[model samples]
Target: MVAPASAPRDLDRYQAGLAQLRSHYEVRTAWTSGQERGYLAAPDSARTAALHEAIRDADIRAIICVRGGYGCLRLLPHLDWTLARTHPTLLVGYSDVTALHLAFYARAEWTGLSGPVVTEWGDIDAETTEPFRALAEGETPTLGSNALSPLCSGTATGPLLGGNLSVLTRLVGTPYAPDWEGALLVLEDVAEAPYRIDRMFAHLQHAGVLDAVSGVILGTFRPGEPPTDRPTLSLDTVISDYFEDRPYPVATGLPYGHLLPRCSLPIGVPAALNVEEDTSHLQVLQSIVAE
Candidate 1:
């Protein structure tokens, strides 16, 4: 484990998560940070060095972040893409880690998971971890959600890309921005007001990201506390204005992101998106880990 973003606020909970990992697999920590440092888990130089060490270590097959808060974007310029590409280490985490996922993907074509961080593992139940376990074991599991609701009707097959929406929108016009062409964009966010969400989606549209993606899978966008002081449109209303009549497939209520029992999705893997009148699901076409 490495803390590339924020350090765990509760060390005991972090230890519990480590115990859980040790129960299943041999676990190691390259470095850690304490809350004394303030917002960043560690200095950018130290975080980048530790990450590079993990990347070049042949024994480390995967590099999982301890938690996600902020600071990952600061490490982008210092990342060793040549080493990362050659080593092919899988990265795991979500939220602020989305910056790293997309940057590694854009730079080295690295395929990682937008799943639980170490701190989150302590609280995640079996069902929540099963999909991640299956993927780590090289099993391609079909993620079908009965709760999926289609906003637009169609089917699309493409490499699955994307994570936290706010994190992704920040990459626009940067060298680390993803190749949006023919991608199945998966998105989620937490604690943002509906207007902010609307602005980000508009930013995507303005950047031509919306036009390039083959499909869109909307995940949990848990709203922040509603404003009682003014009139505002509902979250559903704001979102529907953009996707309800898209040319490609679009669906919401994917069981991923911020919430528990979230499915672990592989970035840069071929996947199929099916959105029909009464059915919706995503099927992984192949294992993310090469044999």
Candidate 2:
């Protein structure tokens, strides 16, 4: 899928991972161009067209994005929502690929995977990929964080939604933006400074999207040290400023997101979040795969 910028540097690695995947499922690949590596601005029309054709193919059971750098937004206007709605399998990826997840959920309520891309296959430890593999085999995936710190402890449940904060916010006013209402929102981002995170949260709040969320599951915020000048606000303060007063639970410590050892989440599926006893857990309440 490589919807965003491609990772030609990992072509051999991607092929090896795909070959491994093929041993497990009826794997398929789409024709792409050198431009898809994002050497140029956006992917060629042939690459985008190939993606459209792949989705409409009834035989395709899932689409795994190759990598995420930057390019999905440009391709959004070019996708065919009609053919996309007919897509019966899971859409998988994270980071910039969140654009496609929100679009798929918004346009047709199709399930999406907020997990590893093909380039990351080498890092797929069993602890991380096992639940995803189980889900791929038509079993409902189970997720639990080893630790969850409570901001507002309580219990809530709703369809799971959200992805990389920067990417999700990019779609806010667009037609592809998801109506995050009645959702147990899960959010994670990488490298963005605390103030930038605060601004994005303010944007979501102003857009009236947070009003729809029943609870929030926070994942890794900064995969590395945030580049900030002195007197920088704490990310915790920013999160609490937005979430502490909410009636629903707001918790952190999800294993999914930019860090290693992650699990794939079924976007838009019902989820249960409990923050009672100062401990927390989130569970998908229904099956994502069709029987």
Candidate 3:
């Protein structure tokens, strides 16, 4: 485990998850200033060193993030692309970790997992752990969801990309942002108001990102604050206002994001989305792991 973003707020939960992980594989922690409590897991120098250490270590096949609150963007410029390319370790985490996944894809043409973090292990159910296990074991499982609400109808295929909407929006115009052209943009977030969500969508639309993707998979957008008496647009309304007419297909309720039993999505892997009537199907086209 590495604290590349924020420090784990709940040590008990962190330890419990750590124990569970250790039971499956030999786990090692790349702890630095993150050993102390604060908003950031550590200073940029310490966090960067820890990440580099993990990347360069031959024994560490994968580096799992402790949590995601903030601080990943700060480590972007300092990341050594050469070390990452040469060592090629898998990175695992989501939310703010999206920055790392995009950076690896953009800079090193590497793939990572937008899956559970260490702190979430204490309460993760078997269903949630299954996808992560499948991916880690080199199995390419097709995640088809007849339960998903298909917003647009069509079939599209591209490199599966993107993560938290808020985090991805912040990456716009940065050197780390991935090329959205011919990519399947997966997005989800938590706690943001509908208006703020709309604002981020508007930002992406204005940036030409919305038009460049092959399709969109919308995950859980859990409400942050309670509803206010002030007039507001519903999330569905806000989403439709932006993507209702897009040529590419758009599907909602991907069964990922902040909700439990989140499926592990492979960043930069080829995937296909088929939407017809009210159903949406997602199929991972190939193995993310090398044979």
Candidate 4:
């Protein structure tokens, strides 16, 4: 389901991209444009019913958003998660879609994928596309990197959860927010200042969100910059201080965010985080479903 804030004129490009991705997969149907423009803010009661019916009728195995904007939260309350629970499917998206993922995670315990969308589909490199394909086919994909902070030199296993940092932070006060306990919390963001990142971490610490998680996997904080006015803490400092003395392992520098060669991670799947001598590895234990 494509949930865009506003419809773009470049529908041709969008269709071509979808065609490219479909060339690699067996896509039977596609759903684009919700009931409203620029976010389906409180989709009408009828439209809500239509949404549920469409999903049910299509028996969608996977639902990917068109793009991320600011309106996903509006569709949350109107969604019939009870119905969704009965007929579970893979929900794939990122950025603003993080709001929806949090809602599904907390409300229905639904596992989703934090990966590419329509716009990013064909544009992604082959390396990035391979992991996504592996995930969609219910195959476990192991993610590893040689560059990392090496916070804890051991392995931890739990359900994988998390996405864009700013989007995840927006759920801190809401019921949809995830309880990070025993979860490998992966996080990434784009164009955020280092100080702002520090402040958000402070908020997480104050809320006790960081302590409950089994481990931390830092994704690419793309276009991150330090403050210009005064000396500021680095992303590493923020992470080190937050996870210090915590029981779970904390590692950074994974290629899973708004960067080239992004690794597509299946949220709500049992996964292992192995921090070895020279590399960190993330291995999915099962598909993100009951099957």
By lDDT, who's the top model here? 1
How many clashes (backbone N, Cα, C below 3 Å) per candidate? Answer: 0, 0, 1, 2
Per residue, candidate 4 scores C-alpha lDDT tens digits across 20-117 of: 76877655433454445434422445435544664576456777766676666666778887887777777788888788787787887888888887
Q: Candidate 4: what lDDT?
A: 0.74
Per-model TM-score versus the true fold? 0.97, 0.91, 0.96, 0.87
Evaluated at residue 143, the lDDT of candidate 1 is: 79
Candidate 1 local lDDT, 149-173, one digit each (tens) = 9899899999999999999999989
| TM-score for candidate 1, residues paired by index | 0.97
Worst 10 residues of 3 by lDDT: 30-39
lDDT of 3: 0.87
User: Model 2: which residue pairs collide?
Assistant: none
Model 2 per-residue lDDT tens digits across residues 1-291: 434545546678777667666666775666443554445224558557767777877877778877777767777788788887766568788888888888888887787878788777765778777878776666654466457778888888888989999999999999998877778888999988888999999999999888878899888888345555557778888888999888888888787788887777788778889886546788777777755
Q: Which portions of model 1 miss their true places by more than 4 Å?
A: 33-36
- By TM-score, the better pick of 3 and 4 is 3
Better of 2 and 3 by TM-score: 3
